[model samples]
Target: MIGFGLRLTLRGGREAAVRLVVTAAAVALGVGLILVTLAGINGVDAQNARYAWLNSGVTDATSPTAEPSPDPLWGMLGADIHDGARITRVDVAATGPRSPVPPGIPRLPGPGQYYASPALGALLDSVPAAELGARYPGRRVGTIGAAALPSPDSMIIIVGRTAEELARTPGAAKITSIATRSPGDCTGCRFGLNADVLGLILAVTSAALLFPMLIFIGTATRLSAARREQRFAAMRLVGATPRQVSVVSAVESTVAAAAGTVAGFGLFLLLRIPLADVPFTGEPFAPGDLSLTPVDVLLVAVGVPLAAAVAARIALRRVRISPLGVSRRITPRPPRAYRLIPLVLGVGELAYFVGRRPDTTNGQILAYISGILLMMAGLLIAGPWLTMAGSRIMARRARRPVTLIAARRLADDPRAGFRAVSGLVLALFVTSTAVGVMTTMIAERGVPDAGPAARGTLMVDLSRGEAERGAPEASGAPVPDRVLAGLRSAPGVRGVTVIHTNPLGTMVPVGRWHMEAGLVACEQFAGMPGFGRCAPGAVAASVPPHFGAFDTSASSAWSRTVWPAAAISAERLRDLPAQGVLVRTDGSRQAIERTRTALAAAFPDPRWPPTTVAEAGADAENARILAGFQQLAGVVTVVSLCIAGCSLAVSVVAGLNDRKRAFSLLRLAGVELGTLRRVVVLESTVPLLIAAVVAAGSGFLAARLFLEAQLQYALRPPGAGYYVMVGAGLAVSLGVIASTLPLLRRVTGPETARNE
Candidate 1:
């Protein structure tokens, strides 16, 4: 019986051969996409593992006393910003001969030596020594290995320093051994998203891509369903049992699915190298990081074919039960309005949560995710009813035979019509929600543009280790005369204001109000904007805390009372040591760079690098994170749209094949080819446009609700890219459906009218 089924599937002529080919191609694409997504998830884990050792440090259990252990190493990690790129600096000093070595380097370097990653080496070679290399002040030893670097583009430097140097540095730690896990209090060692968040993101990404693939494969397997049903019915009428017919259908579908699965694996291998170059997380992946495990390979190899066989078996249920009914072309019952209940309930669930301020407890998070999943499932369930309603409206307003014919066809089998556009609906929904949330976040958290005065002002915290530790005064040894002289004499130096913090609880007079504020040289304060000007003959001024980089919010009571106030000339404070300095430049990029270089050369410590007023307040890390999310969203949108296009094309071709006989009869009876083509266009266009609008609306609403609940962010419209993405997606789907129109004339030719 199995051999008989195989023979029938193999020798079923041109139409059967076309079906086989279409099914295979569709399955290949679907399988390939799934494999790629899995590879990316695996790669992220691998990259994280490689970085864990660097983040690990000894806890209180390992280092109980302040006294240095004989065999332990003292390590200090800091960052240096050059051209807006962060270069990670790891300073280490061996306490004994037995100190353990880190992963990438050959050995612990002595004082005045350092090892640079390949990328950092290239960058150091490209730029001048004053700008970056001056801060390192060490002889280059060897290159760090790939095992220690997160990506090929990562910039890292391991510098050797004395034990006294590390002890003087803030946030330094003792490490007995290098390990994959860090202690609980080791905050600086952690990088990127936590494990749970990363898992959630990967799961969401998989779902976003997986559903469309499933739809495409299902549509492929059901191609030419009418003809296949008729053939199966004829077999049932003869000696063939229901079980035999089911085996034949499954075998036929499995053959194509198995072939496609193998081809998809080959396609994945071909694309892996290029895919590694995609900067999904600000850094491109390593090719080996994306390699699939044996279990992953086995799953894709067997799972896709089994799923195809099951879908094929289910599609033939009618033939197995009531073959005579299928031959008579009996229509199934129309979908009821109840299909919309799930959609309403899902929206209500989200609305209920959105109305309140919910904490990020596990229950609340689960509820939010549940609401989103329900809405997604509801969209699929409610699609047929919505398509049916739209078709009915078109039928009522029909002025041409094409409109009436298309509407009737859609109304008769709305599920089949809706299936073609369902994947598209989901894709638009997911992409719209992602775009809405990310756009709002980028706008709110992005760095604000500095005004002209602020742009030229560089704030250097001269406080030794106090500023890094966030001490109350942020005060330390005063700026030496030589350091101040070098800064003033630096190129593009316009002015320098020496800052001195007033002792805690001391109030200084500024206008009628007396407040505790930092004291700055009155002569220099007059030149800086936003800070109030000093009174005439005043030698010093009492400026607000964080004076130079003060918040510019007009509504703030602090800003209202602080700026444009009185000043006092106190000679005693003028001669006091300076805890910080405000260096003003000529408001040019070159001037800023030159001034920064001079400061770097003077202050060799990387922890307290010169910072612009803008950098002090700006959330640069958050901006980078948002950019990564935007890149990921783009990849998801593109992949989903492509799969949706394929699903639309496959469905159109299959519909044409299934109705070729009917179309042929219409042509012979005087229906023009142009009119038939218009009917196809209207049928695809109405459902597509209607579903797209619903999906987009639902997506935006969900995003807004999520933001309100999670972050309490006010409602704001998504950026222009959202609209452009929707427009482009719709245009591409219509174009794909139209591409199948040329096949219409061929399928409905005069010869097609003849009985088989």
Candidate 2:
């Protein structure tokens, strides 16, 4: 029976051949997309594994120890900023002869030497010593291996320091061995998105892509349904049992599906290198990182064909029950109104969670994901009912032959019409939600706006005590006069204001508030505008304390407080060491770089690099992460829409083929080609527009609720990009449908009608 099925499928002439080819192509695309998604997920896991050791801070001892006998290594981890990019700094010192080595390096470097990642080594070679290299203050021994780096672009430096030097650094811990396990729920972990969040995002993305591909494959298999029904019914009349007929249908679908699956895997291999270049997490994946396991390959290879066969078998139920019924074109039962329940339930669930407002991060994410999944499933289920309702309205309001013909056809089989555009509906919903949340986040968390006057100013922390809490008290020495002289002589120097903090913890009365005092030289303070002017004849002035530029809480605390510039004598100022320095410059990039270079030269410690007000206000790292996600969302949306477009075109062609006899009768009765084209347009457009509006609205609502519930953010409109994404998707889909219009004349021609 299977051999007979193969013979029938292969020898069924051009139409059957076309159907087989289309089915195979659709399955191949589906398979390829799935494989690509799997690769991405695997790549993220691999990266997390490589980066695990970096976050494994001090497993041997929780705190710095004065009397450590057994531990071989003492390590301290910190971060440095260079031209808005973060560099991970690991300061390690060997306390014993047999120290455990970290991944990618041969051994811990001896004193005054360091190992840099390949990217960091290249960066060090490209730039001047003062700007970045002086910060490391060591000889570059070699490059860190790929096994130790998260990505090729990662910037990491493992500096070798003395045991005494590491003991004086804050956050240093005695390490006996390197940890191989992942850092679970470590808030201070260096990697972007923890494992939980990354897994969640990949799962959502896979679901969004996979569902559309499945729909496309199903649509592909059911092409030319009326013709297939006739062929199967004829076999029923020729003494073929219904079981035998189903086997033939399944066999035919499986062959194309199996061939396509293999082709798709080949396509994935071809695209693997290009896929690795997509920086979905601010860093591109290593090509080898994006590989599927043997089990993954086996499942996709086997499952796709099985799914296709099952779909084909289910599609032939009407033929299997009463083949004559299919030949006579009996209408199926209309979809019930209860299909709307899931949509309502899903929306209600989201609303409930939003109003209740979960306290924990995990709880909030779970609720949000559950609501989203339910809504997606609901959209798929309720689509046919909505299509039927719209078609009924169109039928009643029809004032033209195109509208009447389109409406009547859609009313008879709304499910098929809705299914054609269903992929697009889900795509728009997911895209809109993602884009909306991301845009809102970007807007709310935007860089702090210091006035234009603050642009030229660079703030440098001169207090060694500020670097690490556990550092020796002797480290808090006054800045040398030579360093001050160097800054004053640096190119683009306007003036330098030496800032001093109250070491005694004294709270001087400013207005009604007794605020902690920060002292600045009154003469230099007057030259800097926007930061209040000092009183006349005052030698020293009191100002808000200068923490790092990125310290928003401190800035906000003093924003409304009016600080009185209480005069202090120069003799008293001379008693205090300069805690920080404010260097006013020419505001040009060259000037800023030169000033930064001088500061870097002065201070070998990179922990507190010179930063401008703007640099402090802008959260570059978070922005880059969000941008990666935005790119990912955009890619998924485009792919889903393309798949939807293909499904629509195939469904349109199938519709025409199924109703060739009817359309031919209409053509012979003087129906014009333009009217027929308009009919096709109306049918695809009405259901699509309806589904899109519903999907987009639902998506926006979900996004808004999520933001309010999770982040306590106010309602904000999505950016212009959201509109552009949606508009482009609709235009592409309509264009695909229009492209299939020419096939209308071919399918319903007198020659085709006469033969059937």
Candidate 3:
């Protein structure tokens, strides 16, 4: 039976060689996507792992044998501690770049002070260093922590050492500044099972897999079943049992499955190398990283065949209705069951989810899952209705004869219409997804807040406790103090406040996690220009203090601990004290206020007006990152749109092939050659315009959904880039159709009839 089945399958496939090849290519593409997806997940995970390792020190460096080096900015990497080293922490106030003061208080000076041990301070004054002006450039600063300063501490600077000695010494002065950054928390997975990165990979992979898999299976089964119609009828006439014939059919399908399985697995192995280098690798497989466990290999080798067998078994049902069955194909339904099952499942699951955990990650995951599934169901249910409605609408108003014929053809076969257009739907889903993410990121871009001025920031470097007078006029420019006075005397300058910035790292305990608390101090914004405004005592914070919690390679803790809750410029609330005890200074809170007030009064000329005070660090790197994100989205959308256009062209040509007889009959009825060509163009154009209209509407809706949340605080809607993108997509599709018109004319000629 199996041998006979194999022979029959091979014979059947011979008649559909072109189709089989196309199906194989589709299957191969699907399988390749699966591999690529797995690889991408691995790559993203690996990258996140590296970042987490670097941030959390969960993994030790691989090259510990290399000589420890000193960092000019961060100080020595490896250094010993020294006893009785009178080390101190200091703040620095350097003259800032020349720029217009905006409408708010200027930012507190950034940390740039030099710190030192008492012994090093005395050496800086006595050195040949004095000849090159090696004196400390900030206010007198004192020590804070009790532990004797580490050798690498800038405050514990070694005096009588040459540059060579500094490099050779294993235990040089070390700076002991605790980082304010928090570590990753594995316990608190940010998005839970709705992992954004994972979901993104899954969406892309599933789309790639489903389309090709369905198309391959559908075409393969139809061709096989159609060819065997007569043979199966003969078997039935000979009194062969329906079950026997069904078994034989299953066997034939098994043969096809085997061939396809072999082809797919072979392709997987062949492309494994180049797949590694593909852009946006879903999950990466390094050369040796093609790690398949015994179980995995068994699954791949044996499992793939079983999956194919199942598909074949299901398909064999169509062949079961006695070889003499009248209909060779299943009539297309509205997919009501597809729509209903998900709706029922989604409703139940959603109800349970909301009742159990309404606002948690679990709830969010359930919501996302239900919404996406419902969307799929809705699309299926709506597809037939839309196709029928579109067909009628076009046929009613179609002015061109070709348009009328195309519309009637579509109305007669909504099933084929739906299937062919499914490619467009897939393309839109991907394009919209890419756009949504890209736009989400782009909307985040903005002018960084410039903080209050620091004309009298009282810069102090504890590492080299030698204070010097200001060089405000050093570079042939007006003295900064003088400039400050001039600005204060100008129109917009308000209350003069002298703010001090001292980099302080605090320890925070949230839930089960221990995290570092980084603090920056400045008066908040009171007003601003075209953008928006801000005030003193207001602090703004990043969404999460530590971006580290997303790493799964570290702790197995059950939840992330929230820590150091403060915005970049959140207003200092009434409950919190306005002033706290200074770190190393010996003074009461009142005394501290007194000192601050005195300084503010003395430095009236250096006061940064409200215009210059920005709450956030306005760095160039942030802008660059945002730009890169938006650019990537644009590229993906353009590529997908182009692919979609090509796919549409192929479908149009295929439909034309299916309709050749109809076209010939019209020609025989005296349709002119030019009129026939015009009809062909009209047919393709109606559908293209319909698709374009729907696509444009969908893209607009997608953009609105994406930007709505971000625009709550801002005024302008994000500009309509998607409109331009949709227009581009339409133009490309129309261009391809128009270009193919001449070739289409030849298909209706006498030579074409002989070939057919």
Q: What stretches of model 1 exceed 4 Å from their correct place? A: 8-11, 58-70, 182-189, 355-365, 449-456, 462-464, 467-478, 503-517, 526-544, 547-562, 570-573, 576-579, 586-594, 601-605
List lDDT for all candidates, in order.
Answer: 0.76, 0.78, 0.41
lDDT (tens digit, per residue) of candidate 1 on 1-756: 778777777888877787788778877876787788778778777776666666646342223433443588888767777666667788999988988788899899889999999989998898777656767777999999999887887889999999888877778878877755422224455554343555467678777777777787778777888888888888888878888888888889888888889888999999999988886766778889888989889988998888766766776678878768576776768999999998888888888886674566566768778888888889999999999999999999999889999999999999989988988988988888888887777667765555555656777766555656787553455667787788788778788777786654456544356667677777667556444566566676666545334433221232223333334445656655566677888876656766777777766566667776666656656766677778888888888888888888888888888889999999999999999999999999999998998999998888888888777776578778778878888888888988999999888998998864
Candidate 2 ranges beyond 4 A from true positions: 60-71, 185-193, 355-365, 446-456, 462-478, 502-517, 526-544, 547-564, 567-574, 587-590, 601-604
RMSD each, Å:
4.1, 4.1, 16.5
TM-score of each: 0.90, 0.90, 0.52
Q: Over the full model, what C-alpha lDDT does candidate 1 score relative to the true structure?
A: 0.76
The order by descending lDDT is: 2, 1, 3
lDDT of 3 by residue, 98-207 (tens): 31111111322233333344445554455343211132234324321212221112233211223343343332323222221212234321111212534364454455
lDDT of 2 by residue, 637-702 (tens): 778778878888888788778877888878988999888889889999999999999999988888
Query: Candidate 2, 152: how far from true, in Å?
Result: 0.9
Per candidate, the number of residue pairs that clash is 0, 0, 74
